[model samples]
Target: MKAISLFSGGGGMDFAARSLGIDVLFANDVIPETELTFASSFPETDFHLEDIRQISKFPSVDLVTGGYPCQSFSLGGNRNPANDPRTFLFKEFARVVDTVKPKYFVAENVSGLKSIQDGNWLKLQLDTYNEIAGVGYNIATAVVNARDYGVPQRRKRVIIVGVRKDLGVYYHFPKPTHAKPDIAAKKGLLPYASHGEAIRHLPLDVPGEYYERPHDPEGNFSWYYMSRNRKASWLEPSYTIVANFRHTTLHPASPTMKLLWSNLADGWKQKWEFSSEYEHLLHDPTLPVLEKPRRLSWREAALIQTFPEGYEPAGKLEKKFEQIGNAVPPMLMRAILQQIVSGEGLLQFPSEHEQYLTVGKQLSLLSEEQDIEPIES
Candidate 1:
């Protein structure tokens, strides 16, 4: 079966689909900076760099998958649906899907979408899909964590998969190959990939750049992102990687550090002085300052997101980070698509591209964490 991807960000989902040997007829993304990255890996693909809304026609393909913009509905952004024009871009997705009439369609968004406005917006989006063209689609939506599917990061996303009603098929999500929770952890049921486990194989002396920034150099940085949660340990799976690399997860080599900010009558006083370029931070008198020697290099960040080794990205430093941060984490996409495509009898992977698919499939493929070696580049 062939595929046509929309709002494709760095082609993560595209790579996953191709891993299963699903040939992508065409693909489109809004960011021009990502074309080189996608093309570098998939030279045969017809890359379209433009807004999805401008797309009047799309190649007819069996599957359509994309992570429509979720900044507005994301918990990190203003939850106002009226104010965020990007959130409305789903309508364009609907337009293409309805026009092309693919057998299946998949859309990914931030899980916080379910909580915004008491889930009204999420319900509306699904309901709208039901009447796209004639009998529409039977859409199934679920919140999935990437760590549960062999990725090192604990990124949670709301995946919405729609099987065209005319196809008379239903989508079955893949079961978690990786485990979480204390019981599962102790049972040794494919424990979530640890920070160290995610990048232990790579040597610190690699020829590529190794950033030396000071921040969450010990654990995943979620403790500081949203209000700290119980699972806020740095040793656990990493936090959701956003496009902003500067504020991303610090390398695990550094010990855990804290930034103390307290409530004041006016509002709050921040311990990590924002104006100081994060060079000087204030911590509790009891907690000593941890001196971090390096930030997570781009390659390390990509590895944590389960991007295959030797999958050198394109563009400048910030653009490279944007492509990695915005991607769907191909490991997670493969988990879901593997199950879905298996049902469609699309299990045979093409020989030529099999190497690309196998990039990160070693221990991660089995959901078992293990030490890796320096990439054979």
Candidate 2:
């Protein structure tokens, strides 16, 4: 099947689609650097460096895959996706769907889209989607956790799959492969991927100031692990990968912050309080055991996002992290594709990949010219 990639940042979704043997007929992103990023990695696709509104037409394809600008729908901002110009960009997505009339369309966005103002915006979004598509389209929506789909990180995204009603098919999301973090396996679910297991091979930096770790400019490694005020374990999945470049998930090396909960004498006023403070350990009665804390490097962040090592991002250091963080975990995307595509017309999904899924340390997806030694186990 062929696809048109919209808002294709660093070609994360595109890469996943290609892995399934889906040809991306056209790729577009507002960020010009993304064109360079996608072209360098996927020379086959026709990369377009322009806004979605500027592109009057796009080649017809079987699938339309991309997550439109998510900042408006995200929780950190003003939470005005309903009225924000960026949120309306989904209409552009619908525009292509209407014109190309693809058999299936997959749209992804931040989970916050489900409810910002009592789910009023979500209702508007679905209504707009159905209106633009006219009739004979069945849209299925779900808020899925990436970790549940086998991703090492605990990222949750709202995915929508629309099938042409003529196909006589109702989309159903596939069951998760991984269970909740630190939870025992129950029936079919497996254990969540932990930070230790995800980047255990990458040698830890020797107490660094900067987040960037030098890896011979050809290899990947862990760099910085800035302290986060949270009590977590290497046994649990990494926190959600946020698009904010300024903030990063804490590493597993550090001790989980200690949480203190107590009830005060005042019944109605200040009745309860809780704290996850590291300061409490500074002057404790005895020495406190703690691992040195650090911030996740760009490579480590990308690895958590489930991108292959060879799938490098271009542009500035901050942009690299932003692209990776904002991207749809390819492994999560692959699982969605398997369910949507089924056995229709000779599928080549990760279910039976000839080589292997984008796991471990090697960049097996790359050609010999860009190949490097796999990270030691």
Candidate 3:
């Protein structure tokens, strides 16, 4: 199989495609840093370093894969899907698929799209893809957690797959290969990967390995960041890696933050700070700072996202963080592709498509302890 990757950041999907013996003929991204990183790693691909809207030509291929920008529909953002221009980027994805007429195309975004406007936005997006030129497509969507696919982070995203109607492909999202400890034992699945497993091998003090540099302790940790616990222990998966390295999850060695008070008048608000036991150490000149609430380095973030240790994204610190945070975990994409190539998903008609959308309990962004209701398709 072959593919053209759009909105390709550091070629995460391209990396997975190559691993599965799928040839990636063309890749596109507007960010120069991403192009530099992508070019270094994938010298064989024809990469376009320009806006997606300006690019008009593409090679014919079997697949089109992209994870369009998610801020427009992200829970952490304004959540204004009704008027946000970014939310309509999927139409550009559909346009490319229509032009290439690929047998398969997969689009991914933050799972928040399912809840925006009560899933109507998702429904409309689905209809747009299904109406593509010729015989149209058989569309299926699912919300999957990165932890379930062997990534050491708890990132969740919605995946939409379209199979051309003429192909009569029997498609379903892949079954998870990993699960929580208790759930894995009962289901005979692998235990979830932990943050330690991803970054423990990297020597923190190594001078030459530039990627090992940690976030400055003096960097701002906004009130919003401290609103909940950001520390993931050695045995747990790291929190979602955002584009801003400063706001990334705290190192596993750092103490969990403590919420001291809360107010729910205008909106849910809370006051949090370093744990009582650890607070004294910050001001004590006699004691050595115990990691001092440092954010994960770009390399550590990359590892938790399941990128190869040797795969260094191009450019400065902030750019690297942006690429790594925005990337779709390669392992997650590999699982999806494996299922598609193996033809192992159960067969079903369009009416039963909703059953294939695997919705599960998700960790709320507001508080690590809160369990928000998942939107059903």
Query: Pick by lDDT: which candidate is best?
Result: 3
Clashing pairs in 3: none
- Whole-model lDDT, candidate 2? 0.67
Q: Which residue pairs come into collision in candidate 2?
A: 224-295, 225-294, 225-295, 226-294, 226-295, 231-257
Clash tally, candidates in order: 7, 6, 0
- Best prediction by TM-score: 3
lDDT per residue as tens, model 2, 1-377: 99999999977787788888899989999886787788788899898888889888889788898898888878777887656889788888888888888888888988777666655565665666666544546666666778777788877777777777677665666666776534434344577887556866666673432143445442212211222343245656788876655566655554444323323344422211222344424544242333455566677778888888766788776778778888999999988887766644223222221111222211222221210111111
Off by over 4 Å in 2: 133-135, 181-184, 206-231, 255-292, 343-377
Clash number for candidate 1? 7
Pairwise lDDT winner, candidates 1 and 3? 3
Winner on lDDT between 2 and 3 is 3
| Model 1 C-alpha RMSD to native | 10.8
| Reference-based lDDT, each prediction | 0.67, 0.67, 0.75
What TM-score does candidate 2 get on C-alpha atoms? Answer: 0.76
Error of 3 at 273 (Å): 4.7
Q: Tens digit of lDDT per residue, candidate 3, span 1-377? A: 99999999977788889999999999998899988897789999999998888888999999999999889888888988767887788888989998999988888888888777667677777778867879777776767888877889898888888877788764677767787788778778888897765787775543332222348452346566776567776667888988876677776655657777878575766666776355424444343234555667778788888888788999988888889889999998998888777767535554243332322211112122221122111
Could you tell which candidate, 1 or 3, scores higher by TM-score? 3
TM-score of each: 0.77, 0.76, 0.83
